[model samples]
Target: MTQSPAPLPPPKQRRHLREAASLTQAQVAERMGVTGETVHAWESGRTTPRGRRREAYAKLLASLTKADMVTNTQEAAPPPQVTVCLNKKPNPRRAVSAPTPAPITPTPITPAPITSAPITSTTRTPATRTPASTSAPVAVAAHGPVPASETEPAPLTPLTPAQAFDALYAFCAPALVRQTYLLSGRRELARESVEQAFQLAWQRWPEVAVDRDPAGWVRATAYEYALSPWHRFRPRYRHPEPPPADASDRALLDVLLTLPAPYRRTLLLYDGVGLDLPETAAETEASTPAAANRLLNAREAVAARLPELANPTALHRRLAELASAERLRAAEPTTVRAGSERRARFWTRAAVAFTVAIIGATALTVRTAPTRYEPPVPPGETVQGIPPRSAPGTLSDAELKLRAKLRSGILHGPQRLIPLAE
Candidate 1:
């Protein structure tokens, strides 16, 4: 019966071993004849290797573990120091009478433990070694005490939020501005994009500070802002910025602008920024093959127009030179941080005001509204209580006589006359 296979280390230990060996997942995958994703899955415990592959991976991890052990052991031991003594010819009588002194052995000092207290400069005095006897010279080999600063480095103080934000801005803003210029071909817009990206970073410092790659976060933001199609609609950016003064530079910028935005970004990230294909793909939000295709297309377009830049080295150099020549500058970190805070305050106040206005309108409507519902009255119908007036016709004999009497009696004004009966 075959022996059971050896158990593998835990998933976390497997990843740590690989990192200790300074090997990337892709590198390990290539050696193991598997896809990078497979190695990633193995490390992440999503899947396990089987058969010969399992045996091979176990062996690889074992070797890495042994290597790490050896390295740690070597680092822990202090180096030995040797002192040689030179002596002149001794008198025979004196040499015989004097006893040979025992060699001095220096005691090793244990390294100091690190603490969180602030580091201060202090003078260190070296301990002098004493020999057993002064009559005869003796060579001594001993380990010197390691310097406190070297053995136990002071722990770094954690940066405050503002300090961290400023540091990140100072480190990335200048280079990002240059990169944005290549993406958009507008110096002013490039500056604006970098500033806007920093402002956004300041607004979300907590998220950005804890990110694995804060520079990449800001870079992606700047690129997205710089290459926004909405910029085309802005009156200031509707017309293209003036081309570079040099004819070659002008041709290069024109060619870069001709490519699709995605292709241009991929090319710049891969070639100009010195990022590998995988990283460029991740940043551009595309697959490795798609990013490669875009890069190829972009390079071909540029090479067709400017054949001198056909080589990637030459192209990268040209891109760098082109960007450096432009007068791109980023706003101060303090300014960007203040602006972000101001913008946030403005929006917050506006929201509060809008809510208050809505509440007031609701209250006013409630107060003025008719509480009780009243049914409207319908139109009145004609009543038949009074008979309709008779139309003009020949009067009866009695009616005519009465009318003539009334007309004759009431002629004088103030007299009250009674109606006469016919």
Candidate 2:
């Protein structure tokens, strides 16, 4: 029978051992004749090594573990000691000249009477002040020299919420306005977008202040606002803005605008802003490969339009120049903050009014509505009478004869007897 192979440590342990041995995944993969991704998979426990590779990886891990143990032991070992001659018998011969003199007793002095001086309020002075004269030196001597630590400058106090917000706005607003201008060809819209973004940031300063990248937060907001589809429908933005005065700038801007919105944004983030691929993908909310494709397509389109911008460096430079050539200034931080507050109040009031209106309408409907259901009366129908009436026809012969006799005789016999009907 064949001998059984040794069991390997857990994946986490294997990774720890490799790292403790100062070996990267790539280095381990190279040694193991496997790919770095394979090693990563193994370390991450996503997949396990198998067959001969497993055995070899196990041996490598064991060796690393042993080496790590040895290193730890060495580090934990005590330091070596050295002997000193001062503790030896050298003092017996060298210091035998005379017995050591006894230390003299210190003389006791009476304490002076303490005098309490009236406290006076004085204005503060600078930490480092020059001595006015020899007479001023008395105060210094009385206090003794200030310690080096005390003379050192104090640490800075943390910034207040408003100050911090203002600083962040001042630092990022100008560049953000320029970036927004590139995103949206309209300078006025660009300025408005940036101011709006900062206003939002100020409104959410608590969340934004704690965020890792406040500028990135603001940039994303501004970009979203600048590229909003609603802007096209607005009357102010219905008409296209005037092109740049410079011919080259106009041509470049036109080309940039021709590309699709996502592709343009991805290209600007990657090339214009100099963000790496992953960061660009993150900001644009696209996969790395997708962002890469967008960037490639955008660059190709621009190059097709203006061959001079084929080089990425030239493209970036041209984009920067194009954005800078346009004068886009952002609103003041105070103005933005004030606008945000005012907008917030207006919306809040509008919401309250809407809620009140809804409640009143509901109350009115409930009050006016019928309390009980009433079935509607059915439509009228014709009913037969007790005796049915017959249809009329021609008169009888006898009746017709009598009618004719009366009409013929009535003119002469009205005064005489009228009993002639038989």
TM-score to native of every candidate shown: 0.60, 0.58
Candidate 1: tens digits of C-alpha lDDT, residues 1-422: 98787678998799778766667666787799865545655775656888889999999999999998976675466534333334565555753333343333333221111111000112122222343343443333345444556634355566678877876676567777888888898989989998888888888888887665677788899999999889888898888777889998888888998899999999888778666577678889999999999999999999898999999989988888888777777889999999999998999999999999999999999999999999999999998889998889998999999789777778567767776666
Query: What lDDT does the true structure give each of the candidates?
Result: 0.74, 0.73
Residues forming the 10-long window of minimal summed lDDT in candidate 1:
111-120
**Alpha carbon lDDT at 256, candidate 1:** 92
Candidate 1 backbone collisions, by pair: none
The segments of candidate 2 whose C-alpha lies over 4 angstroms from its true place after superposition are 1-140, 145-155, 378-422
Off by over 4 Å in 1: 1-71, 74-154, 238-240, 375-422
lDDT of 2 by residue, 319-348 (tens): 878877877777888888899999889989
Q: How close is candidate 2 to the true structure, as a TM-score?
A: 0.58
